[model samples]
Target: MSRLRSLGVPAALFAAVVAVALLATLGPSAVERLAVTGLVNLILVIGLYVFVGNSGVWSFGHMSFALVGGYVAGLLALPTRLKGQLLPDAPALVRELTAPPFVAVLVGGSVAAVVAVAVAVPLARISGLSAGLATVSLLIACSVVAAQWQSVTRGQKGLSSIPTSTTLWTALGWVLVALVLAWGYQRSSFGVRLRASKSDEVAAAAAGISVPVQRGIAFVLSAFLTGVGGALFALQLGSINPDVFYLDATFLIITMLVLGGAGSLTGAVTGGVVVSVLAEVLRRVEGGSLFGMDVPARPGLADVVLGVVLVVMLLCRPSGLTGGRELRLTRRGTGRGDPTREPSGRLTPVGAAGGPGEDRS
Candidate 1:
């Protein structure tokens, strides 16, 4: 039973996701699309969790990485003919390169990783709200570049006529891959060291853990995954624009992380699923019908409603839905289910089990 419980967190998440996918098959095409989008959002949230959740730093700028990824993927996936017409002034490499959708996604991740390294070098020195502001600044800078760089980005006109290659199976396959990556990272020493810094920065540093280095590593990995998410987004929409990667999208993605309890991998996945579902419901409400009732169309109502819910959640349950705790299917004899205390009397990656597990930073 303890052995089974050890795998419970990932296993349960896998089952839940599979069940949702199965249900999508029963619905119409629209429902399937929603499922694909939800999967993509989950991937983004997982990326966010890699840095923000484990490192106890809130990043409001990861979407900029997504924007970069989307543009790169969109360009690479565009046909050579269209690229030439769309970006007549672009460099030959930008105008001529063509790759399969999956390959484009991989390239997007690589570029995002490089960008992340550049950002992380400077960002690793800060923490708390300062780091968050720094990231937001990065996002703004990237957005401006996207809007002004006509030769490559088309100056906010963005990419269009890109092939839509992220099907249900493709998205699902990536989702599984993302889950494995995230879970593996969380269970790895890098993630553990980051989380240790999260719990006590001074203590972790005293213990010979290079806090900045760990943070930098997590930041790079997080950006890579987020870039992949961006490519998936472009594939889904069959187009791209600067506006899509700005404030509102950032708010929604961050909300998913906050809502799910950012400390645990389980929280990241749950937050993504729950917030996506809530957003979809709010969208349907905006469509003028809820259940069997006729609702008035209220533009931006979804954001307003979600904002209120977020505030309420912050006031009432800041630790999030799981209270920053992972669900254990069986009580492992070691640590008595405390997520913080490992079998060897060490701290768990995130927090001690049964505690508030709130992020101090």
Candidate 2:
């Protein structure tokens, strides 16, 4: 019951927010697209949160996993005729493949997880800014490979004619799943250990936590979620390009994560929604007059506005909108210092007082 209280309240609140968004945007097709896309972004941002939020590490490379998953699912789900027409020189296995959208998405996510394991081995040993830079290098390498590999990804032109299987309901379903998984994981032993390392690496190691292994687990899980997001993106658009998962997307995802309090699931959802809504509003206003005032269209105005918002958020609320804390309905004094502290700020071993099994409330 305590566990349910811990996870259910926040999940319910987040769902309410999503429900309101859906209702507000239901009539207009463009608005509906924005809502769906926002949900997709929510998934991606939460996927990012699983690692960056828990481990206090930045990753510029998760989008690479997204790209891989998108392409893998898109390629497999495309009609065989379309594949042959667009990717005539694709590998025989790829060209001959066909699957339902769900299966393709699963395969894509699994492949991304495998790649993540390979990447995590080396990354688990590094930390701080050096680790971030190493991940950025990985992103760049993946981008180069994606762009240069014409046969599989269709090169710069991108892969199109994918099945459109990611409706708003579909995206929402996955978002809920991601939310529950993220919340549950954050309260789990692995998540606690990983966050402990984030809070104090040497202390956590001294307490018998294998920091590298915990980090690797988070990385792999994060990659899987990101891959799922990528597959959903392709399903939603019926097309994808390597560029779609590049630097701009990276910045947007990071901004959402950072702007919401990278340490909390509530923050991830809030940040994704806020950024998505703001961007859509800006895009709509970038062209034509507002309030009967003549305003010329600005091609890049939305980006500029987003940058400004991010800067303002950083200056005003460095811990993000949620201050890195989960939302709870009941106000009980838990006697916990720094509610946002990773691993509940407890130094106890896994089964000891204030450990994973202890009642947080």
Candidate 3:
């Protein structure tokens, strides 16, 4: 069946991953910890895919929405007692903003979208490195605010005692949301316009498309999903600090995007899973004991591995692991290109019907 084929690979892969996770969970505490971390990384990578895959833009600020969503949800979902214990002053804001967990998460996502609209509208008007740099600036600005806003974000200490409402199942549900949105966007008219703009911005504008508007819509939607992912991440961890969102985190995302191939939805997903798993594997490898003396694995090992993967991918095949194209198991060109050649809408060449070589009627 069509449905079976559509799910065929993902289903098999999911089963395999679940089995492996079950096995790993029985290991030492570190292995279990790795599973949780990987799940959170999976969510972040999928959110990045929404923008990077469709719009063909490298945005370094996806984590800004993560911060926004995390804080919004944290503020809303944190227990009233904890909020009081942390910051006794803003009872009004806390009272006004209290919400059910899911509702609070949605509100956080919506807030991120609103912010995206304001931030992206102007930036979307530009392209290439300018837009990228502008977004990087946005992320830095967010970090500054998050660090200094002691009352709302609790500054570096961060609001603690968040409820652990996200499980592996819940994370998968979020991934499904991201996958559907990414797939639908990749096939829609707006997606087509966005891709065209990426391919040739001048031609798209000449065709009467509003390039800036299209870019802004994609950028904002991407931010919304990224925000939701952040909320889920906070829920999974049951705590958050501003340090979680930083330049190192941004580079991790970039490395995932570049390693997996930047322009395809599948590539983004694959890149996320691959990098997440690889990081976990490397973490398990503390320098082994030699002659009863232990050599510990230092921090930055994961970064080293990702850096090597990225370099190799860029040098060997810059298009990415998937080559910026979808797998698309269906018949090639079945419903694509030169529709006039088809029986339903066949048309003679412009000159064929009334050219100088035409026979006399």
Best by TM-score: 1
User: What overall lDDT, based on C-alpha atoms, would model 2 receive against the true structure?
Assistant: 0.82
lDDT of each: 0.83, 0.82, 0.70
Q: Please give the RMSD to the true structure for each candidate, in Å.
A: 4.4, 4.5, 8.4
Q: How many residue pairs clash in each candidate at the backbone level?
A: 6, 0, 0
Ranking by TM-score: 1, 2, 3
Candidate 2 residue pairs that clash: none
Please tell me which predicted candidate would have the highest lDDT against the true structure. 1
**Against the hidden true structure, what lDDT does model 1 obtain?**
0.83
lDDT of 1 at 273: 86
Error of 1 at 176 (Å): 1.4
For each candidate in turn, the TM-score is: 0.90, 0.90, 0.83
Cα lDDT for residue 276, candidate 1? 83
Q: Write the per-residue lDDT of candidate 2 for residues 101-138, one digit (tens) a residue.
A: 88888888888899999999999989989998999998
Which lDDT tens digits does candidate 1 get at residues 1-361? 3333455556777778878777888977988999898988888988888888788888999999999999999999999999888899999999888999899999998899999999899898899899989999999999999999999998878889999998888887887777777766765678778888988999999999999999999999999999999999998899998998899889999898888888777778888888888888899888776777998887888899889988988999998876666654433355444453333222243455432132221
Worst 10 residues of 3 by lDDT: 350-359
**Model 2: ten consecutive residues of lowest lDDT:** 343-352
Error of 1 at 195 (Å): 1.1
